[model samples]
Target: MTQAPGDVVLIGGGHTHIQVMTAFGRRPEPGLRLVLISDQTHAPYSGMLPGHLAGLYRRDEMLIDLAALAEATGTTLILARATGLDLARRQVLCDGRAPVDYHLASIDVGIIPDLSGIAGADRDGLAVKPIGSFLARCDAILGAAVDEGRLRDVAVVGNGAAGVELAFALAARLRARAQASPPARITLIGSGPVVATLNAGVRRHIHRALDRHGIARRDGVRIVAVEAGAVVTATNERIAADTVLISTRARPPRWLGETGLELSQDGSVATAPTLLAMGREDVFAVGDCATILEHSREKAGVFAVRQGPVLARNIRRRWRGEELERHRPQTAYLVILMTGDGRAIAGRGAWLAAEGRLVWWLKDWIDRRFMARFQTAI
Candidate 1:
C-alpha cells in the first residue's frame, strides 16, 4: 500500500460518518487517504433497538458492520477508543495504540446519560447508551430473573421516549420469560409528565399504552437516588425494584474538555452551520458530539441521520479548497413512538397524532430501508 499526500481521519463510526465514508468510497480523492477509528465493530441502528429488545428483531438486523464497510470502501479501520486530541499537531490520541496523524479530522462520538443529578445513580443504575453495554446488562437482568423463578420489580428512570419505550419493551420481554412463575411488575419513574417533549396528543396515546401493558407510571416526582434495591425520591419516598435502568438526560463525554476545541455550554464541540469547528478550518464535528452553534437542536438520532449528507458534502468541498454548504435542519419532523406490541404513535408539529399497527409498519419500513442502504452501499 502507498501513503497518500493527505490523511482524512474520522474519529467515530457514527451515523454521520457512515455517509461520509460511503461517499468518499464511491468518488476517491487521489491525493487523500481515508481512515476510521471506532471502539465497536457494529454500530447499532437506534430506531430498531427497542424492537430488538422486545424480541421482534434479531441483533444482527439492527447492526451496521464497520469492518465490512471499511473493506468495501478501501478505508483503513483502527479498532481503538479515542481519548482526546492534539489540536496543534493534528493528532488523535488513542487508549492503547500510538497517536494517529491527520491533515483533516472529524469527531462524531456520541453522548452518555448524565447521572450526576441523581445520587447513587452513577454507581447503582445501568446506563442505556454506548448500546453494546446496555444490551449485555439487559441480558444479565433477564437471566438472573429466570434463575430466581420470577422477576419481582423493575424500574425505569426518566420519562422521555427512550425510557418509555424501554419500560414497555422490557415489560413485554419479561412477561414472556415469566412462564410458570409470577408475572413481572414493571414501573416507570419520571421527573415530569410522560414523554414531556412530545405533543399532548402523543402523550395521551403513550399514557393509554402504558395502562394497556400493565406498567405503573409514577410521574411529576423527582428521583433523587438509586439505593441498593430501591430508588429514593426527592420527597423521601422509596420504590422497590430488582433492577434499575437509567435513560436520563444526555451528557457530552468529559474527554472533549481536554481537546482545546471551543465547546458549547453543554460541553460538545461548537461548530458553525457547515459543521466546521469554530476558529479552525482543519477540524469538523457532527452528530451528538457536536453542537451546531447557529441553530442548536436536541441530541436526537434524527438530527444525526440528517447531518450525514451535509457533512459528506462539506468535507468534499473542503478537500477541494472550495466553499462549503450550510445545513439548516428542519424545525419539526414526524415522531414515531413504538408501543412494543405491534402498534406505534406518530406525531408531527404540535397538534397531530395517530396510532395504529399501520403506523408501526410504517416505522418498520422506514428503518429497514435505511439499514438496507448499508448493505447496498460502502
Candidate 2:
C-alpha cells in the first residue's frame, strides 16, 4: 500500500478534532490522508469534567484515547505540542519533530488558564484549566490532606460555571473526606455572580447547590494577588486559604499569537464561516482556540463537538476542491449541571430548573453514551 501525501493535519485532540477522527474512521476518504497531532494521549471530555472531579467517573472513563482513535481512524498520530504555524508555508511546527506540511490544517488546541497577569498566581495558586496538570496537583493535595491531619482552607477564585462546578465538587469531596477526619473550609469567590452567563433559573439552581454544600459564595470579590497562606482581593481583603483554585476566563495558548494568523483581541485564532482561519483557506480552527466570525458563543465543549462533523466535511471538501459548508450553532442548548451529589439541574433558555436524581441519571446516561463512542474498540 502506498502512503499518500497528507490532506488534513489537525493540531490538538480537542472534542471537534476527535469527532473528525471518528468520522474518518467510520468512513475514510480515499487519497486524503488524515493526521492528528496532540500533546496528550488521552483528551478529557469537558462535559464530564465536573462529574469526574466529584468522583462520579474515573479519569480513564472520561478521556478519549487519541492514540487509539487515530489507529481506528487510520490517521497518523503525532504526540507533540504545536508551537507555531507558518501560514505562508502551510506547515505546523511542533516542539520536537520535523515540520508537518499540510494541504489543510485545523487547530483545536484548546485554551489555557490566564494567570500571567495575576500576581503570584503562576507560582502559588493551582490553575485548573489544563485537566492533565490539575489532576496531578489534585492527587498531591488529597494526599497531603490525608497525611498532615490539617484541614486545608481551599479558595476557588472564579464564579463561572467551571468554578461553580469545581467548587461544588471540591466541597463535596472534602466534606466526604472530613466525615472521617477534620473538615476543610471551602470558599468560592468571584468578581461577579457565579454562572452569570447562564439563565436565571440555572443560576438559582447552582446557587442552591452551593448553599446546600455549605460552599461560601463571595460575589463582587476580586483576587488581587495570591500568597502562600492567603489570597488578597482587590479591596485588600486578605482571605486565609491553604490552596487556591484558579478557574477564571480561559486564554488561548501563547503559541497561537506567534503564528501570524489573524487573532481576536482576546488572542483566539480568527476563523471564517467554514471554520478556516481568516485569509488562510488552507488553515482551519475550532474549539476554545478559535473565534468564529459569523456566530460567537461561550467556549463550551458542546459547540466543539457539534462543529466536528462540519469541520471534517469542510476539510475533506477542501482536499477535493469542493465547496465548504457553514456551521450554524443553535441559539440555546440544554444545560445539565451536576450538583456533585446524585442530583442534577436541567435548564434550557429561560425555562425553570428541573432538579432531581433522575435528571442526574439521565445526564449520566447521555454522557456515558457519548463517551462510549471513543472507547477502544474490541
Candidate 3:
C-alpha cells in the first residue's frame, strides 16, 4: 500500500500523545506517515508516580516504553529534542538533527518547574519534573542514606497535588526504611492549604494525614529563597532542611512561545475546542503543554488522557478536510489521590470527600489497569 504522502508528527511522548500513537497504530490513516519525536525513550505515567516514589511500584511499572510503542505503531521515532518551529516553512527544528517536516503537527511536551526566579533554587533544590532524572537522584539520595544510616530532613515546597503527593511519598518511604535512624523529618511548605484545589474536606483530611505521619506543615508561607541546609520564607522564617523538592507552579518551556502559536499568559499554547492551535488548524497541542482556552481546565493528567482520542480524531479529520469535533472537557471529575502510603483520598468538589485504605486499593487497581494497556500493542 502506498503510504500517506504527508507526515503527521507527534512531539513529546506524554499521556495524550501516547494514546494517539496507539490509536493510529491500530487503524492508521490511509496515506499519512506517523512520526514521534521525543528525547526520552520511556514516558512516566504521572498517575502512578507518587506510588513509585513511595516504593509501592517498581520504576518500570510506571513507565511506558515509548520506543516499543512507536515500533508497534509503525512510527518513525526520532530521538531528539525539538528546539523550535518554523511555522512559515512548516518544519520543526530539532537539536543535532535535520528539521522534521509535516503536514500537521501536535505538541504534547509537558511543562517544567519554574525555578528561574528563586534564589539558589536551581542549585540547592531539586524540582520534581523530568521525572526520570528526579527519580534517579532520589534513588541515589535515599540509597546513600539507607547505607550510611543517616536521617535527612526533607522539605517539599508546593501545595498542589504534585507537592503534597511528593511530601507524603517521601515520608512514607523514609518511615518504611529499615534504617533505625530517627524518622526523617518531612516538611510540606505551601502558600495555602495543601491540595487547595480539592474539596475543603479533602484538604482537612490531608492535613490530618500529615499529622499522622509527623510531617510538619507550613501553610501560608511563601519560600523566598533556598539556602544550604534551609529554606527562607517570605516572613523571614528560615526552615531548616537538608533536602528540598520543588513541585510548585509548572511553567511551559521557553520554546513554546517561539512557535508563533497563540499562548496564554503562563506560556502554554492556547488552543480551541477542536484542540487546534488558535488561528492554525494544521497545528495542535495537548496535555500540559497546551491550554484549552474555552474550558480553562486545571493542568491534570485526566483531561490529557481524555483529550487523546479527540486529538487523534481531529488530526485525521483535518487531513480529510472534515469539520473537527469540539472536545467537551468535564467540569467536575472524581479525584482519588495517593496519600504516599497504602491509602488514598477520594473526593469530588468541596462537598464530597473520604479517606481510607479502600480508596487506595481502588486507586491502585485503576492505575494498574491503565498501565496494563501499554504492556502490549493497541
**What TM-score, computed on C-alpha atoms, does each candidate reach?**
0.96, 0.96, 0.97
lDDT per residue (tens digit) for residues 1-378 in model 2: 223655689998988888888888888888878898888888888888888888888889898888888888888998998899987788899998999988778999899988865799988898987988888887797658656866568899998878888887887677666652557778999998887777888887888888888888899998989998899988888998888889997799999999889998789998887998889878899999998877887887778878988998898788777889998777788878888889988887777578889999998998998888889572
Model 1, which residues run further than 4 Å from truth? Answer: 1-4
C-alpha root-mean-square deviation, each candidate: 2.1, 2.2, 1.8
Candidate 3 lDDT tens digits, 114-146:
986568998888888878888888788767866
CA RMSD (A), model 2: 2.2
Give Cα distance to truth, residue 154, candidate 1, Å: 0.8
Evaluate residue 102 in candidate 3 and report its C-alpha lDDT on the 0 to 100 scale.
Answer: 86
Error of 2 at 261 (Å): 1.0
Better candidate by lDDT, 2 or 3: 3
* Model 1 lDDT per residue over 1-378, tens place: 233478889999999998888888898877887899999998998888889988889999999999999988878999999999999899999999999999889999999888888999877888898788888887887778667765677889988999998987887687667672677688998989998878999999999999999999999978989988899999999999768898888877899999999999999999999999999898999999899989998888899999998988887788888899998877788889788889999988899899999999999999998898786655
